[model samples]
Target chain A: MLDKTTRVNLLYDHYGALLTEKQRSFVELHYLEDLSLGEIAIQFGVSRQAVHDHLRRAVDQLEQYEAVLGLVSRHMRRRAVKRQLAEVIAGLPVDDDQQRRLLELVGELCEDGNGTGGGDGDV
Target chain B: MLDKTTRVNLLYDHYGALLTEKQRSFVELHYLEDLSLGEIAIQFGVSRQAVHDHLRRAVDQLEQYEAVLGLVSRHMRRRAVKRQLAEVIAGLPVDDDQQRRLLELVGELCEDGNGTGGGDGDV
Candidate 1:
């Protein structure tokens, strides 16, 4: 259950910006802010049920995008590959500085994953 | 327009499986099969307008998923990175076999992008 929440959080982290303003707000309040349905309803001037409905729809959209694109999963895999490459490089006769540079490149790849996801207008 | 079609084709390649059956069929017929609107409508036992509606909705859905997930764009960037790496590695003082191996690894990364997109159930 803990892992599920974390995974959902990561998905939201990657896709939240693409959601509608209302959906984005609802998701952030419920998930990140840890607000109860009634509390979120009060903040948004809606009923608790409406708050729930919005949050559900938003989460559904996020999940659908993930199902098709698997961006989050792809990033995770790239990180795994990088880690493996690091492990393999460790056994090589390369100097410490070269190994460190390769590892740093791997780290940058992970960070760049999120940034480029916004696509053409962004770059 | 040519570029747009290519871009949409790439999006469909990654996401066609996630679309509904009707949507997928319509997309395949109109885009890939290059059938006339009336031809597809007759084959599907529907009006041309209905076929248009399904295709429009499917394309909209695909575009939405891409906007959020950017899997196609990410793959494109990774390919670009691989190309750049190939160029860089070409100038390195490494043996020919080692350089070839690194370039081959980069090529595999591009190919692997589409495979893991199916995720856990796939692996």
Candidate 2:
């Protein structure tokens, strides 16, 4: 049986792109809907191992797609930076000048890529 | 030295929230900007091991966050489903009735989780 964490990760990695209609149904029933593999197998009229194999293959394909495209990677990075900026903003002492400067920096970082116009140098 | 795959995965998992400013900077320079660990260490005036440790800790934190909260997992699943839908649409033959039904189903799935109101049943 796949652990919840692994199943969730696999879904995250490929839920929209890598699965077929049948495979997608399998994963949704098994993971998001919290159905057992055996139940899914019964529903789909397949063996438990077949369901497991489909999920495994789907995850491998999704990982491969991510390896090539990197959209998920970029999104994750932006999220991390945003979270860090929020923390910084929240933790600042009550200095108006410092707060203004920090907020400006945060805005700059949060802006769309072209706004800064630096070639990764500022980073 | 971190493999590119693991580094990328780490960034995706925890890029914005879990890393400190310094840790975020280190990962960006190393992964996004393609800087070497030794170079980053030299620039930050720290040992290579320190950089490595920061990255390792950051990755661990990101993984922990994902384990607990699961935003990344949800995003990944949505992406995979979208990809599969695209493929199915592309591969279908030029039959109007089937095409119309498929398109409708696609629209429903792509909807913002409210319109059809079907629970895990539709899957």
Candidate 3:
């Protein structure tokens, strides 16, 4: 079974794509493989602090990658908006007029046309 | 313009969602805002090495987060697979028979059906 740290590192590496190979490996072994820092150090024949240092540096790199890209933020924002829209649709009162209006709004939001504002339209 | 370190850190924080507030801010200023180590030290009222230490630790945290959660990995994998598939479709010869086969495969891949294998079908 994968250790928590390694698994999390893998996800970050995959998404961030900015980590060094050594850093990625360190994360995988320590975090996903559930190996202790000592174990990793032993296996890699490095000091425990060295392993720790690498892990720490790797995290910084991942964070740096995200801050520059903003892809994750955009994705999360879109998800939040979609979730909010879903809630609004689900909570609408059963009046025919209200239902129709909600449906229309949803359709507008989901439309492929370029006329809608307040969206990240194609640049 | 955001510094390199700060921008990179923001992306990671937004995606990773595992960093401490201090770590995020440090990353934002250093990486995205392009502040120097010495500058950041003065601004944060910490030693240069202290800022470095914070940035390093923050990276470790972000990597640890990714290791535990495979969301980033999954997203990358999906992107890779999609890119490969797109390349294959784009490179196909103009033969009608091949076109039909390719279209069929694409349709199957895109279908919201339960029978297809080789996909991360909903569990």
Candidate 4:
């Protein structure tokens, strides 16, 4: 299993825009900016416990979004499949135009997969 | 653009379980069961307008979910990529064990992609 921070970061990447402004700020500050809970509390003019509670709730909401939508897990699996495909293409003995074309297609698949899935935006 | 029925069906497949019971029932009755709005409203002891309103909200919610998550778009693109890969694999000159294995992997990717993204479940 991924560590909590890593997992939350992954979830945040997929569902951050869905969060409210305060929740999004807390996540970005605490996780991406590496702010301590106390520091975030000071920045937001709230109690440390309040900040902690808000962060916990925001993280739970992110996990819930992942549970329902599952974009993160699907993206990861697609990436693994693409990697495997590249490996197989590399091992092919034929060095003809078709082989090169296959390689190019694999390259495009990797890039296209990332382009489609890496961010939270309408496509 | 997909026809409205086709688009709603696709979105429903991806996000049906997230909907309320009433919304799910109306959509299933009208779209999946081919029941008209009046038929569904009569069965539920409500006005046809009420049924229409519920279905419209439900479909809008499903589209909202898709707009944020983009799972339907990703699934479609992935299917297209898999088909292209299969075509290239079929045209390859090599007729060896490796070719067979590559074909199997492509098949597995197709199956695995569907298994992961076709329904709503926590994987």
Candidate 5:
């Protein structure tokens, strides 16, 4: 299982745009910027309670989106699968040109967490 | 670009759960079940305009979610990448056990669209 901060960061990457502007700001400030609740409250000119509420709601909303869509979970699974694939390729008896090329392809997909393939149009 | 029906179906797959019950029902009825708007409204005991409004809003919401998350887009790209990976493996000079195994792995990932990997736990 992923740690809370890492999980929230991954969730935010997948569903942050679905959040309200204030909620988005609060999460970015608190999580990404590593700001404390009091600091965020002071920065946003809101009470600490309000900031806390927004952060909690925003995180809850992110988790809710994950629960429904499962995009984040799928992404993690794909990454893991790609890693296993690379391991299998590496275990082949001979490390020839073909093996090297195949490993390169696996590396590309593994690095491309979103699977854009560097916009090569020939993935 | 995908056709309207295909695009809507893909979007619906990614974001259908985020929709309200009525919107979900209307979309499933119209798109998945091949029911007409008037038919849906009559079945639900609502006006045709109301059903149409719900469908329009629901599809719009799905598109909005895609715009933010891009899960559908990434999924298509990943599928394409897997296909290309398979082709590369097939074209290898030698047809050995390792080559066959690599192709099988690629085939597994390709078939598992949501990347669950058949619950094998090894993947």
Candidate 6:
């Protein structure tokens, strides 16, 4: 299973804009930037409890969007399939030069990709 | 370049969750489903002016999110690059069968993909 933080990080990348500014900021700070609730509260000039609530609400909202749309889940599955295809390409009978070039081409495609390439795990 | 509707459609796909439910509903009805403004107004029991205002504000917010984060733009670029890579794969010296299989594999990867595949020609 993916850790809560990693899952939330992916969720935020996909749907963070739907969150209120305060919620987005608190989630980003707490999850992505590794800030404590107290620290985020200080930065936002709110109580720690308030920051905690904001983050939870944001997380819940993210989950709700995912439940409704399944965008993140689909993206993760597509990325996984792509990675497996990469492995299949590696196992092809093509020579080293051809394989390297093909892989390079794939990498170029990924140059502009969202950071959805690898999954340490998923929630 | 993409038409305004195309651009907004992609934007909606990426960030519609950030909008109010009403905003999301209006945009979906008008854009994806191609409902007339009058129809949407009747469906929602609102004035045409109110529907228009909601859509305009939602579009503006989508644009703002794109400006701040560039997610839709990056997705467009990435999708473009992947298409180019697919073309390159098509050109590779692999036999016809291998090429066809690779194409099929790529298509499989995209099976669970977002509907971001073709440009049809972006905004």
The candidate, 2 or 4, that scores higher on DockQ is 4
User: Mind giving the per-residue lDDT tens digits that candidate 2 earns over B83-118?
Assistant: 555554455443566545544544433322211111
Q: What is the model-wide C-alpha lDDT for candidate 6?
A: 0.70
Candidate 3 lDDT over B1-123, as tens digits, reads 655454345336333234555776777676667788899899879999999999887766554544443333433443455455545445543455644554444333322111112222111
Off by over 4 Å in 5: A93-97, A107-123, B93-97, B107-123
lDDT of 5 by residue, B1-123 (tens): 898888888877767777776777888899888899999988999999999899998898778666666667766876777777888777765558878878776654543243121221110
Q: Which model is ahead, 1 or 4, in terms of DockQ?
A: 4
Which residue runs of candidate 1 sit more than 4 Å off their true CA positions?
A34-42, A45-57, A87-123, B1-4, B47-53, B95-123
**Predicted candidate 1 versus true structure: per-residue lDDT over A50-85, tens digit per residue:** 998888887887686677557677667666666565
On TM-score, the stronger of 2 and 4 is 4
The per-prediction CA RMSD against the true structure, in angstroms, equals 5.4, 21.4, 18.4, 4.0, 6.5, 7.0
Clashes of 5: 0
What are the chain B TM-scores of all models? Answer: 0.82, 0.60, 0.55, 0.80, 0.80, 0.75
Query: Clashing residue pairs in candidate 4, if any?
Result: none
- Interface RMSD per candidate (angstroms): 6.3, 21.4, 18.4, 5.0, 8.7, 8.9
lDDT, candidate 1, B65-99, per-residue tens: 67755667766766666656556556555676765
What is the CAPRI rating of model 1's predicted complex? incorrect
The native-contact fractions of the candidates, in order shown, are: 0.13, 0.00, 0.00, 0.21, 0.24, 0.18
Candidate 1: count the clashes: 0
At residue B117, candidate 2 shows an lDDT of 14
Evaluate model 2 with DockQ and give the value.
Answer: 0.02
DockQ value for model 1: 0.18
Better of 3 and 5 by lDDT: 5
DockQ of each: 0.18, 0.02, 0.02, 0.34, 0.26, 0.21
Model 3 TM-score relative to the real fold: 0.34
For model 6, give the RMSD to the true fold.
7.0
Among incorrect, acceptable, medium and high, the docking class of model 2 is incorrect
